[model samples]
Each structure stands twice: as structure tokens, then as C-alpha cells.
Target: MIDFFNNITNSLIFNNFFLVLSGLDNTILLLLISLPIGFILALLFALGRVSKIIILSKVIAGYIFIIRGTPLLVQIYLIYFGLGSVKFIRESFLWYALKEPFWCGVIALTINTVAYGAEIFRGGIQSIEKSQVESGLSLGFTKFLLLRKIILPIAIRKVLPSYGNELILMVKATSLVSLTTYMEMTGIARKIMAKTFAPIEAFIAAGILYLFLNFLMVQFVKYLEWKYNPHLRLNN
Candidate 1:
């Protein structure tokens, strides 16, 4: 209706629009900071899972299990309030880092994503043919070299689509940081809605921004997949 359109237009006036955009940038900053760190940790865990050491394997498995089984919001709260509640933590060297809501959210999201990403990567590594490992090992490839030259690259290619989904999930998950009073896109939208008494318009703007971000991310992932899978491109 005309009234709805007018409300949206009015709500998105320059000042309000910029506030919403700032929130989205916060969301993006959270994702950008968390993801690479998470991926590195995940790759290490995945390697541990496939390692021959039973103790190391079990420890990594337990870590993945615990993180994957819990709700992310609960993890966020636990890191933000629960840890911060501890007197010892408050006095520790880590206190400086744990004291901030943004860092707490980053820690939670990174841990959660690492759990999922490790599994995806583990599966991809396992999917590689046994013969390839044999071939690499026979060719004087050290275990480290074999993994770097053979396993990781192939596994990465195999996991790209799944990892892409995980990336998008992390982007959306950043919205939950708002519960900690770290005003990302969703938090800003809520504030605007409260002030203007226009929940629908505020939410719609936030949703569109999220959709746009996810769209660009999805396309980028697809391009990566295509770039890596040359044989598929050749077949096509």
C-alpha cells in the first residue's frame, strides 16, 4: 500500500539509513575477523582427527562434539557473562580480551564455526582415494608434504560448497551478537524500530541488507568452486 511504501521511504531517510549501514558493517567486521581464524583452527583440528595418535584424535573429537552439540546463543552468553562472572578470569591476563562484548561474540562464533568446518574438512580429506595417499607416500613425499601437496588442496576443493554454506551461516550468526549489546545490523534495526514505531519497515531494511550480503557471499563461493575445479570446467 502507499502508506507502507511511504513509511519505508521515510524510515530510510539519510540519517537512519546510515545508522542501519553502520550496523551492517559491524556485522561484516565480526564475520571478517572470526572466519579466517576459525578456518585455520578448523584445518588443524581436521588434521588432528586424521592423525594416528589416539589421544589427539579423541581430544579433537570431543572438542568438535561439544561445540557442535550446543546452541550458539548459549555459547555466546557463556563466554560473555559466565566467564566474565568468574573473579579469577577477571584478574587473569585474558581478562582484557574477555571483558569486551565484541571479542566474546567473536570467540563464540569462531569456536562454533570451527567445530562444523573441521568436520566438513575431515570428510573431504577422507573422501580422497586411498591410492592417492599411497602414490604420494611412495614418491618420497613426507607426510607433511603429502598432506600439503595432495590432501589439503583436494580436500579444500571438495569442501568448498559445504564451507560456503557454513560461511553464510556465520554471517547470519553475527546478528546474535546484538544480545550482548554489540549493535550490529539487527541491533541497529531494533533500535530504529523502537524509536519510529515501525517494526516492519525497520526489519525489512535489515533483512534486505542481510540478503544482499549473503547473495554476494554465495556468488563469491561459487566462483571459488568453479575456479578450483578445472576438470569440471573442462567437462562443461
Candidate 2:
């Protein structure tokens, strides 16, 4: 027990604590960039999923299926390595962003999450009581107005817990970008391990950092759940 504590202290304090900490900036940036884009795109996809148009719905379903079925790492590889190899892409304006591991990671993450998020949002939207739609229609609300006024607000609250889980998953998923040499927390931890030959020490610190971040998010989500979900609270 004493040795474990001492080693962790050494790893964090005496080792490359600052360097590992520096990776937090990119980690935060990557999360901030990808999640919002993924979210907006996912909402659009979810709308497609729930659309009355058969072809549009099928196309969205196929996209979500392909993304959810494949590994995110493979998607990352295709974006960074496979797409990067294309002659047209290499010569085009898109290449400027595609060539950078950071942007590649962001694009891959956004694409990957959009599928899952769309499903989550679709579920939430579907969960709204059918009567709720009827109620809006009885009031002569237009489809677009009803959706904006009633559907979106309730669905967002309904999906809070599920979305919180997605948030945690994305936090961990960001670590995969380190493999592309983006030097996020996990990347920096790998470097420390390489230098000190202490995998446990480096990973333990990295794990702790991630754990704390996720923990805080979990608490925040729980608070939101408790706040927005008043009926559940009233039951208590």
C-alpha cells in the first residue's frame, strides 16, 4: 500500500505531471469540437429517422447501421489513412483539414457519435406520448411549430440520462485519438510509460484524471435529471 502511494506520487509529482496535464487542453478541445457538431448532425439524422419519407428514413437508417456496426478505430483509420490516400482528397482544399490528425480525429469522432446519438434522440422523440402530438394538433399547431414547441423540449429532457452515458463514452473515446499521435492525456501517459518503463504508474494517473472528469459529469447529469425530471422527484 505504501509503495503504491509512493509510486503514484512519484509518477504524478516527480515524473511528467505538467506534460500529462498539458494534454488536457487538447482533450477538452476535441470533446468540445466534436460533441456539438455530432449533436446537431445527430438531431438532423434523428429527424430523418422519424420522417414519413420512406427513402430518406432508409438512407438514415443505413448510415446509422454502418457507423454503429463498425469499430470507431477503423473509422478513424479510414478517415486519416484511407481518405488521406485518395488522390483527389490529397489535392483538394479538404486535404488541409484531413491531413491534420486533430481534425481527422474530430471528423471521425463526430461521424461515429452522430449515428449513436441519432438513435438515442430518435428513441427520445419516439418516447413522447402519442397524445401529446394529438393535443398539439387539436390546438391547430402546425407540424413544424408543434415539433419545435412540444416535441423537442420533452425529448431533450427524456434523453438526458442516455445522453449523459453518451457523454461518458465520448470522453473515453477521445483517448483513441492519442493513437493518431495527437498527444492527449493518454498519449502523454504512453510517452511517460515509454520513458519510465512504468505502465502502472502512468496509466494509473491517467485513469485517475479520466475518472475524476467522468465523475464530475456524472454528478452534473444526475443533478440535471433530478432538476428536469420533477415527476420522478415528486414520486420520492
TM-score to native of every candidate shown:
0.93, 0.91
Cα error, residue 93 of model 1, in Å, equals: 1.5
The 10 consecutive residues of candidate 2 with the worst lDDT sum are 10-19
Per TM-score, the best of the predicted structures is 1
Off by over 4 Å in 2: 1-14, 234-236
* Highest lDDT scorer: 1
The sequence of per-residue lDDT tens digits that candidate 1 reaches over residues 25-97 is: 7898899989999999999999999889999999999999999988999999999999999999999998998
Clashes of each: 0, 0
| Clashing residue pairs in candidate 2 (N, C-alpha, C atoms within 3 angstroms) | none
Candidate 2 lDDT tens digits, 150-221: 998799899988998998999999999988888899999999989888888788778878898899879988
